[model samples]
Target: MRRRDFLRTAAVFVSGASVSLSALEFLDPGKVLAAHPQLRWAFLVDTHKCVGCGFCVKACKIENDIPLDANVTRTWVERYVIKKNGETVMDCPKGALDGYTSKLLDQGKSGKVLVPDKEVAQAFFVPKLCNHCELPACVQVCPVGATYQTADGAVLVDRQWCIGCGYCIMGCPYGVRFFHPVERVADKCTFCYHRISKGGNTACAQACPFGARRIGNLRDPDDPVAKTVLNQRVGVLRDEYGTKPHVFYLGLNKEVR
Candidate 1:
């Protein structure tokens, strides 16, 4: 049977949400290879294009069977406000599942005194995810070898083999890794491997109406996303770590970390 069709029939539920059992193939050893062996996957985020709508976060939860009310998520958006005095404030309320409507800074959220709009220099939203680095620290630190990177550059946690030791969580510089609330295994972004393998976009990318998020095969010369990455100036998080992150950002402000 076709992989997609078979996956549908093998639906499994986690935390009352239905997910395809086959979608977690990295858990099944010897099946961790990418569907498109020649493709090197990468992700792009346009900071200017993102509007803090949180649609991506909501769609990711539904597509991945993550509990809606869970405090953790595979992806999240952060709002950064730069004060005229050169101080920066960052906050992500409930992983930005609800759209950002508040213009005023919340002391409770940012752990600082509220700054009047007149004192704010600029504000923007940045989406965060597993960078799927070329040399992923999560994969390097997985004692049981539960965390690994697929050939196409997607990082996945083998839920069945994960010992819940939290080593991978601590190893990640991006602060993207977390223990699955239900499974208690190391969990992070998979780049929506299940959907991408079938020639579909990541749930977050698909749900984004503003064209803020995109994914593509970096090896494909004809791909628009790849061309953009090759031609345009893009920034990545924590470049000093030397993990060589695959996720790139356009119009990234210096205030961002």
Candidate 2:
């Protein structure tokens, strides 16, 4: 099917009021909640206070038991610090445990961190993962239907059905999805589906010391995500791609690549 057609069909399937177990039994609601007559969850990451901390990254690796050398990062932070000469720079240490250490080390042994010319200029860290787009590219490109998007705006991979084709990896515009060298299957952030459906928050959001990450139902006006999006001028990455990503960035920097 064409990418647009697939996205439309998937959205309709998820927006349904109820889904039969027989149709969804192959899917693990615990592993990836489907669209049902219930709540939906969305996430928001505040760039204003992220501080490039890799705590969330560490938590994801430890909680999921992902290998230390795996190039397929489920979640990671990118530090962007503009130089005084209008030279914009960015970096993400392969597996930095902490944001500060990664940023400081990026300056090399001299430890001369670059900054913008302005005395009180702004610099921010953006922790990126699967945006869980409403019209997910990964789902559209999955030949075996392994990658799917839940109604709650989460992009998930079915490891059992995955053929290790790596199609989703190429389809994802944000470069979030990756192939697990060991499992030989496609994997990405599930928005911690197991925890969110059971009245809990995602591990990354829960571990955030600055409360920079917030998860909530986008359909609910009272939810923090909804409120933030409504009140702030937030933006999603690669908006022109028409992916309709659910992850919103608060106080996004103009220098965001």
Instruction: Please report, as a residue range, the 10-residue window in candidate 2 with the lowest summed lDDT.
Output: 114-123
lDDT of 1 by residue, 8-90 (tens): 76664333365566666566434444444568999999999999999999999999988989899999999999989999988
Compose the digit string of candidate 2's lDDT tens values, residues 45-113: 898878767889888877766776776678888877766666666667764455566334365555556
Quote model 2's TM-score: 0.78
TM-score of 1: 0.83
Q: What's the lDDT for residue 183 in model 1?
A: 88
Clashes of each: 0, 0
User: Which residue runs does candidate 1 get wrong by more than 4 Å?
Assistant: 1-37, 107-113
Pairs of residues clashing in candidate 2: none
| Best-fitting candidate, scored by lDDT | 1
In terms of TM-score, the best-performing candidate is 1
